[model samples]
Target: MKKILKQVTKYEKRISVLLMVLSLALIFNFCINSASAASGDIIYVNGSSGNDSWDGLSAAWTSGTNGPKLSIKNATGTVNSGGTVRIADGNYNGINNTKININKNMAIIGQSQTGTVINGTDSAWIFKIQPGATVTIENLTITNGNAYNGGAIYNAGNLTVSEGRFTDNHAYVAGSAIYNHGTLAVVYSSFLNNDADGGYGDPAYNFAAGAIYNDGNLTVTDSYFSENCAMYGHGAAIHNNGVLIVTGTDFIGNSVYGLGGAIYNDNALLMANSNFIANVAYAAGGAIYNIGTLAVTGSNFMGNVAYGAFYAPYISTAGGAIYNDYGGTYTVDSCQFAGNIPQDIYNNTEASSGYGSGVITGSSDVQGATVKAANKTMPLQKTGMPLIGFISAVLLVLGGSAVSKRR
Candidate 1:
């Protein structure tokens, strides 16, 4: 009996050791999976005939290839909550409303702008973001999507775009290429050849903003806006109904029919170290039209034209570079308005006085271009970062528990 008991004890000890080894192996495997799910901080694409890498994720998406081709949807995107969604170098195709909505605490990074493309043309936006969700779209091309408001993108949360092309998208009414109602940050992006009919479009109420429309806070840094045509009226390149901050951005070769050849501001617009060149407005405001506060500092406004057959004091008027009417104020500081012919600043009617009466020059009382200088130096914010510590900590805790079991 004593010998039998000894044998049983020895076998029990061996089984315990085997269990510990198995537990340790599981812990190690889990750790490796947690870290290796996403390769790098970026989504890489090798070569492209202008196809987005997100297309690869769509192949694995549950939508079965026929639905909106999304790299990450609500289901799969929720996996590895902090993991990144990578895209290979390939052409991704979506008709309309084919967007990768970033609702999780993750990032959707890209390889290069020249190697990716998002081509969608339907009734919904190509990229749509919800609130509290941060997303960054870098080094890609987004075009040919359709929305009632935002053609290519509609952002309700914080969004940032860097080194990409936004071109040839068409919105039903407003914001042909992009419509922003939340915080927007743009860097080194190119807005080219988007079309939106701004409220006087054919068939009535067909309005569009060729390049962009912002109803929230917007900051453009070192970007270029060109070849956007608002055939109906207002904001050939941009229509801003909220706060617009432009720093070191180039607005050139844009056309608007009614007002603001390059831009139309119904609210606050601040331009610093920017350039508005070669823009044409058919009715009024060759380069810019403001119905609210328009501030310019250290910016260049050159070669803008207002092509109007008949002119009115406030209606069908023309200004070389700028025109403001009814409760709008224009402030200039260290800004060169030369080569912007036919009176740089034209104010038709003011809340208190007539045109040109509301403009307050840099008198001895005001020192310099405060508004312009501030916007010019406006810092670009970074967005679309996930809560990396939260999920990673949880994973670590699980792994540690498994390791302890082994011990």
Candidate 2:
């Protein structure tokens, strides 16, 4: 009788151990499922081979109506706030003739910069970020957008752009690439061959900013601007009506028919470690025109020209490198200005009005600017593994541990 009781007790212990293991397995499974659902916050967009009717929960097509979205518009509409939208490598054009309005905080990431393209096909604006929204765009090419203002993107809220290329965009009024009314930050981006032409009207109309127009705060870092043109306007590369900070940026081969080949500042402007090369201005300021406060440090201006007819009767075609308008304050520190046609710096108050009102301070090398070759090669970095893959690896480890304990 004693031996029988001992065997029964051992059997009960085994059953209890098995039950505990089963409970643990169930709990782990549930946790894994919950993690997967959380990962669904990331929506996938595939321009090709995707169905709109299916739920955009999976990166690829799965059985029973689960797949990526057909267009970025649909994904944006469906994604939750602060979610991410991953776009595949394909040309996304004609998906929406109207602008894609974003009103939520989110991120739009592309597979690659050159491979993933958002071409407006010269139809309409590509994106519009509404007020009170924060957005980030990365690793994409925006091209062929045509609009009255901001051919590629219009931002009324906070925006950040990285590893992006804006090319071949056209605007009728201003900002062929981007128009910002809120805070904007551009990093590791390039603006190329954008044009802002006064459209089908009197040449007297004020059209400006071939690449970017800022009415709010703007910061640019490690970016490149090249071959941007503003016809019958000012500021071929940038028109700043607000505060602007530029660092480690390059402006090359930009031209303007009016004033300021590379930049026109009506407010506070600061530049550091920037380069301006071969920029042309028809009126004044081959590289920069400042009507407010301006400061430049450790910058270089080379081969810039101000040679065309003056746009206004009072405006003089001077200042191949910089033009400080009457009543403007300027300071240059450790700056180099060389190879500029006609002159290097022109203070309008001293030359024309004789007001001597504008304050010009700091030392600059105007005789011979140090020439430094720019290295323009920038490659994109790879991201980490997907969420699903991570979850699977964790589940595998848990399963192996459970099996070992049971053995």
Candidate 3:
């Protein structure tokens, strides 16, 4: 009986030790998961029937069923290191009928490019990224947004957009699609049919960018800008007051009344393997207006038009593809210009008012080519004449080319 009691006690002690070990293991696992969540965690957002108050636990999400986190805002918590919010396929107008503000380092990803749509109201923007934040948005469409600066997004932080579309947005001042006061990188994205019209205010207030206004670093790759308009402002597609880099992109049918139908660069620009087609500017540079350091290589410019103002019909209109001012420095290489109205290259500060020292040609490192700049006889065409010039203008306007008029 004494030996039996000793055996039972020993067995109970072993069982207690095993139970304690198991409890410690469970606690360690929970701690590990919680630590991961504090850093770069993944949260699910279901658009169908998810609740905002519940935590995004794995068991809470089922196939085609609601998740714990319903909206993007609910998914955005105090994850200081960084996190990802996996959004399901649906049209999200934003949480609580307001703009989605991102004040942390996070990434918001959609299930599919076309299936996820973030529609904005007429009062607020779709997304507003605060300063010192790093945010990545992918596989989404930001449409029907409206604001004073960025109709779709107001970014004062580092932003990266991939495989996204910004369309049908309107801004009262600048950046109908995006206002970047910080670093921005765009890949395989598109900005289409956006407007920066000044919204019935003084034209002076609306000064830049119909598609994007960059006061910081801007980089774009494999993107497209189409039919963006800036009324009484510069850069219908993009206004770059900071560093700008564009590669393998296309700017088409953008219109501006001030300068740069496609882009206005006042700082530094590096454009390579891009295309500018059917862009129109009322002042100068139908495709690009450069007043700073500019570099263009392996690009194509076609069907671009630079028309003089209707009131000042005799105004000096030049550079159907590119206009380089006195303060601008340009290097063009391996570019093709075809069917551009007026001229292919115009140097405003040139002694002869055509291509000159403002633009450099072939060098030891650079191999340059061009269609040619127009002579004095081309710029002398009058509207009163029913000659080739009048016929060209009529055909240009009729051929789906955007036209801008400046007083």
Q: Please, what is the TM-score per model?
A: 0.68, 0.77, 0.76
Instruction: Tell me the TM-score of model 3.
Output: 0.76
All candidates: CA RMSD (Å)? 24.7, 24.5, 21.9
Kindly report which residue pairs in candidate 3 clash with one another.
none
> Which residue runs does candidate 1 get wrong by more than 4 Å?
1-82, 95-97, 121-124, 199-207, 309-311, 314-317, 350-407
Kindly indicate the candidate among 2 and 3 with the higher lDDT. Answer: 2
Find the number of clashing residue pairs for candidate 2: 0
Question: For model 3, how does the per-residue alpha-carbon lDDT over 251-319 read when each residue is reduced to its tens digit?
Answer: 877898877889998887777788787788877788998887677766777677777554252145457
Q: Tell me which of candidates 1 and 3 scores higher on TM-score.
A: 3
Candidate 2, position 38, lDDT: 21
What's the distance in Å from true for residue 72, model 2?
0.8
Lowest summed lDDT across 10 adjacent residues in model 2 is found at 398-407
Q: Give all candidates' CA lDDT scores.
A: 0.61, 0.73, 0.72
Q: Score residue 375 of candidate 2 by CA lDDT.
A: 23
